[model samples]
Target: MTDCLFCRIVAGELPATVVLDTEHLFAFRDISPQAPTHVIIVPKAHYANAVELAQAAPALTGELIAAAGDVAKQDGIDSYRLVFNTGADAGQTVFHAHLHVIGGKPLGPSGLDLH
Candidate 1:
């Protein structure tokens, strides 16, 4: 996990605008946003994707989801999209397990058939 981008962020080797940080999670703004309000929430510990994280630490998955709500609330949005791209074909560019909190505007049909 030494070369993982998120691990670098969690360890402070890189810089990201932190949205939320906790004992088990770290959340930050996406460098290239997909929405008016776009943030990526991640576990401090590395997991390849959501499936891997769930398989390993099920309850931690709940924390990740709960953190997403907290993140959206803190950002002043009640309704939002929580996405986990589990694989390359699904648009998961980063290898680390992360949740995307996207909102802040009216979201209609979108890319990847997200209608």
Candidate 2:
């Protein structure tokens, strides 16, 4: 999807404060972070949403979760929140599938509240 924002980021067409990158995943700082160390880990392959890809590709799913853990460790947060806003009701702004790893404080009810 050429119009996808995350695809652009994965392709390096858009500038992002990247935290980590692997053959299958790209982890970068969220432009509108919800925590002090907020990273969005996305797969290189485009998926519409979490539910759509959760079981379709096991390897990709494992890689995504691993990347989130790696990012949390790198951010030096003992604990972090991993979130996947599946649909519009969950507040997913972008259609691309991504895992939000946010920490660096006692995460509140709303995820992290970077503010």
lDDT of each: 0.88, 0.85
RMSD of model 2 against the true structure: 2.1
**Best candidate (score: lDDT):** 1
How does residue 109 of candidate 1 score in lDDT? 64
For model 2, residues 1-115, the per-residue Cα lDDT tens digits are 8999999999999999999988888989999887798899988889988877787787789889988888888888879888888877778878988898888988767734321
Best candidate, TM-score: 1
Pairs of residues clashing in candidate 1: none
TM-score for each model: 0.94, 0.92
Worst 10 residues of 1 by lDDT: 106-115
Please identify model 2 stretches exceeding 4 Å from their true place: 111-115
- Runs of candidate 1 exceeding 4 Å displacement: 112-115
How would you encode candidate 1's per-residue C-alpha lDDT over 1-115 as one tens digit per residue?
7799999999999999999999999999988887778889999999999999999999999999999999888989998888899988888888999999999987766662210
On a 0 to 1 TM-score scale, where does candidate 1 land against the true structure? Answer: 0.94
How many clashes does each candidate structure show, in the order listed?
Answer: 0, 1
Single out the weakest 10-residue window by summed lDDT for candidate 2.
Answer: 106-115
**How does model 2 fare in lDDT?**
0.85
